[model samples]
Target chain A: MHPVAVVNANGASPIVFVCEHASNNIPNMYHELGLNAADKISHAAYDPGALGVLRCLVNEFDAVGVYGTVSRLIYDCNRPPEAASAMPAKSEKIIVPANANITPAERDARTNAVYVPFTNTLADIIAQKGGQGIVITIHSFTPTYFDEPRHVEIGVIHDDDPTLASACVTELQGDGSFVCEINEPYSREDGVAHTLNLHGTKNGLQNAMIEVRNDLIATPDDEMKMGIYLAQQLRKTFKSLGIDLNEVSA
Target chain B: MHPVAVVNANGASPIVFVCEHASNNIPNMYHELGLNAADKISHAAYDPGALGVLRCLVNEFDAVGVYGTVSRLIYDCNRPPEAASAMPAKSEKIIVPANANITPAERDARTNAVYVPFTNTLADIIAQKGGQGIVITIHSFTPTYFDEPRHVEIGVIHDDDPTLASACVTELQGDGSFVCEINEPYSREDGVAHTLNLHGTKNGLQNAMIEVRNDLIATPDDEMKMGIYLAQQLRKTFKSLGIDLNEVSA
Candidate 1:
């Protein structure tokens, strides 16, 4: 199985689309996190419908897109390597039976087999793309976490790429249908700087993480609509910033 | 298939032994990283003999040990959540066919399945053992890396646990048989801080990562002997520091 899929537009454009929390598939071997059929269908097992949206976004824009294939529980693609949550996370207060307790040997094996290869693919994609590309990571967040209602419609996160995040925030805010937040709902202070830090900030690539409410794109139709909407807004923002979207494809 | 294995003496010992790179076994489905049988047995797929050494140490010291089951390449358990080498790595100068190009959903699945749960287990173990305990993370390093000969005998890595590291350094230095260096082989500057920062300094737990040369403990006999030697040294240091090694059993 290909650990990463890339749409190398190979143009002179200044944007790269990345989807970090895109998949929710456990290897058939792991089998539903040791849960029943219904539990497998729960939000705990997958990212609801991030794949459809990302697919649409990649198709609409001629940009390089990078994503992972295994479940985050296996190894969080977005977290730094040293963070406990980076591997065997306990977030959302759920216990993943497949990772409940592991031997050091087992941990190293999974890292070598799955985690390392996935990131390496991203790194290669970025290197091939070369300079002056904005990295936009696509993700989805639960509307209510821990049963607490989160009112923000969208969260635009950035570690230090405020230029792009601010521009996106302004464009998003212009849309009355959504409440645009700059690092709202979540902040980099929590120490989740994996894909963005590595592929974006580290390489001086302008970047931002866009989190849409899961319920908003839970279906194919919604995913497509949301994808087009985001693409248009991001594209317009890039144009205003004097960045040619077509140049990113070169 | 227990993903992680927790082994404790169940007698008396407050020492928590952590093996970061213990195992390197891939699932039978992965098929030795898509290589032939000869390549599978190479250090590429495994950590050589880290597990054997850890087992010997656990058995000899009657200590509580927490190990990760997945490979480090999937998601290095020792790395912080933000480190670039954390998850879904794709390029290690060699291609991992099984993880060549994956989707976003697959990445999340891996994180949820392997990364999150494993760290949670470590956190839970620490919590269960209370705040007063010594955390010793065991790891093995390649003797020859990138075709370069490494001369350091062992690496006693620490970020803020300088007291413990110093004691270890002093002990190793005193032994004339081995040319022990304090941080000569490796240092936190090379990303070792990823592990010590979170589990050790952040939680105020005394900890250090012990890197043994893989060549020295490649055999069962060598592993056992090394395990005993390390355990004795640790026991003596703990006693001098007025730390109770007997409080680690659950």
Candidate 2:
């Protein structure tokens, strides 16, 4: 199976959905990157409920979805090749043994095998939409990191271009659904905005990165609820931005 | 005028030619970034003859060409926004007054105005070519830097992936025309491979960066000769790579 998976590749919608941390399943070739069974399925491997939310949103808008099929521990699709976190030697407190002091050739192998296909398919799909494409990346963070609790439930993040994110934050806040803020938890300075910077702001695409607290999206039903609510808010976001959804290549 | 110029946007060829430092004309809005007339047109502002060669190659193979239309002093499209050289305050000996002490907002303005459009156009064009795209970035460097003389006439450079660069270097050396060497003059370690790494290696495209001495390509006629020779060698390189030119798009 390919490291990247695309759903509704020819979807008519102008919106492109990306889930960089969609799976915790490491490929057999990686041998779980030297992690134990429990640690392999940890949030470090993938965003626990992000894929479920992405699927619902893809169906909600008939948007094209591109997601990672292998563990981000192998290669984080959101990171640039030069970034250390792209293939982290230490993700949080857990040390990734296989990633420790990896050679340049070994690093290139993972990048070629995983990051390339994921990004190319995304770039191709967005190109097929011409100038009307909007990108929205979904992710979920742990309720706590390093014994510190994160209060922000949803993050509406943007880098460089804030048109979509500013509007989404307003819509999310107005809805009173959950605690939402701009650039909370992780910002562009944190090196978490690689996807938003590369595919969205760099391409002049109206884009936003949405992060939900994992506790809020722990189950399939929760994912469905969050996805439906977020979709409504996003639709309203476009409207507030003076964009006509009906005319936006649905 | 747009910061980026795309020639033959719908060309059937599988090659996407990029000239990041194509022009030395800073827009009126920038006021030449506080440089004098001579300094504004210096090799530091833009590559002297890279665009000429790129145009010749684009015509030779009917390949799509995406080039920067503004001076690199305003924003180097080849460098990422976070890179200091993207809008360098001090380029060689000339200090750019406007770029010095620039705030984040000021930086973002230039990135949005110049870098974003230029990269988006190139990325879009490459995506249009699908999986068969080959990226070749054209650049020209000064014969001397910081009072030190250089001997290499043409530098064939690569980053993580060396497939295309190695093949092209072998072909260039076999021809016995120019002093061509693999990763000569400047290698990936010199931070000159941003374009090659970002748009080329990151996407898994067969890619190489060709750097010719500015003195060698000073005239339009010289650019044409160099272009024709490089094009032929690239054709041979593709043949050696087991890629049938006839089977490729165009």
**Which candidate number would show the highest TM-score if scored against the true structure?**
2
- Over A1-250, each residue of candidate 2 has an lDDT whose tens digit, in order, gives 4788787787788899999998775767887788986677678888977886897799788889998877788899999999999999887788889999889998999999989998898888888888788899999998999999999999988889888999999988998879999998888898888887888887888888999998776543456568988999998998889887558784
Worst 10 residues of 1 chain B by lDDT: B86-95
iRMS per model in Å: 20.9, 25.2
Q: For candidate 1, lDDT tens digit of each residue in B1-250?
A: 2346676535245567787555454444445456555433445444555665676677766666887656665556776655555543343334555556656676666566656777777777777667765677887767777778778867788886688877887777676445567665678887766656776788888888787887776443356567877877777766666666654444
TM-score of chain A of 2: 0.97
Docking class of 1: incorrect
The C-alpha RMSD of each candidate to the native structure, in angstroms, is 22.7, 24.5
Clashing pairs in 2: none
Model 1 is docked with a DockQ of: 0.01
DockQ list for all candidates: 0.01, 0.01
Q: Give the runs in model 1 whose Cα sits over 4 Å from its true position.
A: A7-13, B1-250
Query: Could you give me the TM-score of model 2 versus the true structure?
Result: 0.50
